[model samples]
Target: MKEKIIEALKRIEQEFEVKICFAVEAGSRAWGTSSPDSDYDVRFIYVHKTDWYLSIDQKRDVIELPINNQLDLNGWDLRKALQLFKKSNPSLMEWLHSSIVYFQAFSLDGKMRELEDQIFQPRASLFHYLNMAKGNYRNCLQTAAINSKRYLNVIRPILACMWIERHNRFPPNEVQPLIEALIMEGEVKRELLTLIERKVTRDDHGFEVDFPIIHDFIEKEIRHLEEYANSLRGPSRDFTATLNELFRQVLEEVWSQS
Candidate 1:
């Protein structure tokens, strides 16, 4: 495993001509429930040469690296990331605060988070979460019976909506924090906790939570969020300009230091 990771890093450094600034396990393994035969969910960031960014044509902002039996490498384009930052993209925010760190810049991701307050647009963020909730609800909630992952699909987005409503900001991706902020009942809380634990203990056929009672509550929240989402207006032109500037800054910074 160690040799495979090192080889993966070397390939990115040599082939992409970018220093892998950070790397980490991002998915089920990082959260502590990976099966024996599970694949590595390696997520990382890279810095490239300045000339590569000087072109007028849009380049691939993010890179999804190839994987071997033991490793899978993927990364966000720093420019695409900053653009998302202005719109308050939750996944970018989660990357900054990911519990498992492969490599890190003390200042870079942290600085981006700080800039979020200045560039934050409530309308853009609301639309983002609402869209995500709708998509996940559509794909996962086909039926109540035999649909095990439906709760997480609904809960994640609803929690994001709840966070946006309460703090007027994006929600953290840590499942517990999202739940802790809203759900206070003992039995309901236990059900969620048990779901997480069961996932950890079980194999990857996808386990179910023992929460027949909680479906109605989740469904109600989803409907409310969908209704509220309809009223949000899109971001103003000013927001796009700010996002572009931020992205340019990130590109320059990465190129210079590379």
Candidate 2:
């Protein structure tokens, strides 16, 4: 599968005339809770030639391949990625911290890590995760019998919100580390472990009885995080200048070598 992904990336670069800087697994697989039939959610950041950005017209800044049952491959252009990074987009931040790496070239990861502390917006990230938890819970887990896989969607974001409130930074992308750091050795933690075990061992296709303990935990966290997120002040700095400079540096570094 790794080889197939690498070959596909190479084909994408040649066919589209871009250079892929970084790529990683994004969804349940990277979070360590993927089941046997889980698809590969391959996300990447790529750069086109310098001339491609020198136009007045708005060109597409994303590359998306047709999704199949086994692989979902797509990428963001470098400029688009940097713009999102400046805004501290939680999805982009998670991409940077993904545990599974498919490809990395140049210094994109190092450069982003150096600026992470300065650019991270805790308030924005908190609201993002909080909203995710709320929406997933309301949509997927409000019944007696629920899709068991939906628990991770709610629990992971809630844990991320907890991590942000406690540490004031972006949370880890994987759920295990977040669990270890935030949840104590109690019924909630035990229940979460059991859910994760089931998630990885079998395909999630049917509805099952919901875990009341997990439901209670999710409800309490959502209410608490809403209050905490509202208390945080707005972002303190404008990162446009810093990100602009970095964007130019990457264009120079990537194209100059070719």
Candidate 3:
């Protein structure tokens, strides 16, 4: 499977004529709670030769391959990545911190990791997580019997909100650390652990009896995080210069050297 993923990425490079700077697992596999049949969500950041960006015409800044049952692969151009980084897009940040790395060119991934503190906006990230939790809850968990996988979708973001509130920074991408830090003791913890176990081991295709304690916790936390995030001052820093510098550096480092 790993070899197949690499072959696909190589094919993407050939087909698109861009250099892939970094790639990682983005979804349940990266979060450490994937079912046996979970698809590999491969996300990457890539760069073209300097000429690709020097044009007056705007090229598509994203590359998406057709999804297969096992591999869902896509990537953003370096310019698009920097734009999202400036906005502190939670998905981009999570990709930077993802545990599964399929490929990295030069120090692209390392450089991105180093800039996380300078570029991350806690308020924006909080709102992002809150929105995800709120949307997933509304869409999937409104009934007495809920899709079991939906519980994880709600719990993770709620925990991420708690992490940001407590630490005042971007939360870690993986769920276990957040669980360890926030849900150490109580029946809620036990239920979460059990759910995680089942979700990882079994096919996450069926609805299950909803757990009230988890649902109540999610509801209360969402309300609390809404109030807390609203009170946070907006991010004010202008990271355009920083991002531009990094972008130029990567282009020189990857393209010039090649």
Candidate 4:
């Protein structure tokens, strides 16, 4: 499957005439809680040759491929990625920290990691995950028999919010670390571990009997995160000049080498 994903990424680069800076597994697979039948959510960031940026005409900044049962592939243009980085888009940040790396062609991945602290705005990130937690809870988890996937959607964000509150920064993208580091030894922790075990072996449509320990934890955590996020200070620090230099460096290297 990894080989297949790499082949898919290389084909995307060839078809689009761009260079993939980095690619990683996203969604449940990356989160360490995927079912046996989960799809490969492959996301990447790519850069066009120098000439593409020189054009005055507006252009699309995203690449989307058809999704089948086996693979789901998509990517963002480098410029668009950096733009989102500036705004502390949590999804992009998650891509950066994803454990499963399919490809990395240049220094863009490392460079982005180095700038994470400087570019990440805690307040915005906190709100992003908090909203995810709140929305998923309201729409999906309120039922008596919870969609196991939707349970993850709600809990992961709640845990992420807890991480931000504790560390004053964005949490790691992986779910295992968030659970281990934050959710202590208790009924809540035990129940989640049970769910994870079931999820890993179950089919795509697995359902979990609702557990109040999980529910109560989420509600309390959400209320606390709301007040805690408000207490956080202003936006994250900026490093526009540094990012500009990185953009130039990548283009020069990738285009010249090609």
lDDT scores for all predictions?
A: 0.65, 0.88, 0.86, 0.84
Error of 1 at 12 (Å): 0.6
The lDDT leader among the candidates is 2
* TM per prediction: 0.78, 0.95, 0.94, 0.93
Per-residue lDDT of candidate 4, residues 1-258 (tens digit)? 888888888888899999999999887899888887888999999999888999999999999999876699989999899888888899999999898998988889998899887778888899999998899888874565655677878889888888877887778877777888998867788777666767787743555544677878888989999998898887645767777888999898778888
Highest TM-score: which candidate?
2
Worst 10 residues of 2 by lDDT: 202-211
**TM-score-better candidate, 1 vs 4:** 4
Choose 2 or 4, whichever is better by lDDT. 2
Expressed as tens digits, the lDDT of each residue in 152-251 for candidate 3 is: 8988999999998998778878787788889856777877777787788774456443468877888989999999999998778898998899999999
Report the Cα lDDT for residue 30, model 2.
89
Over 1-258, each residue of candidate 1 has an lDDT whose tens digit, in order, gives: 755776777787798787665676766565444546667887766666767777998787667766668678788766666666666666566566567776665256666667666666666666667677677766655754444344555566667687777787656656767777787877777776665555555532555555465566666776787677677665654566655665567566666765
Candidate 3 residues lying further than 4 Å off, grouped into runs, are: 143-145, 203-210
Which is better, 3 or 4, measured by TM-score? 3
lDDT of 2 at 214: 81
Q: What would the per-residue lDDT of candidate 2 be over residues 1-258, giving only the tens digit for each residue?
A: 999999999999999999999999998998988888899999999999988999999999999999865999989999999999988999999999998999999998789989999999999999898999999998774665455577888889999999989988888888877897899958888878767877888644563434688878888889899999999898788989988999999999999999
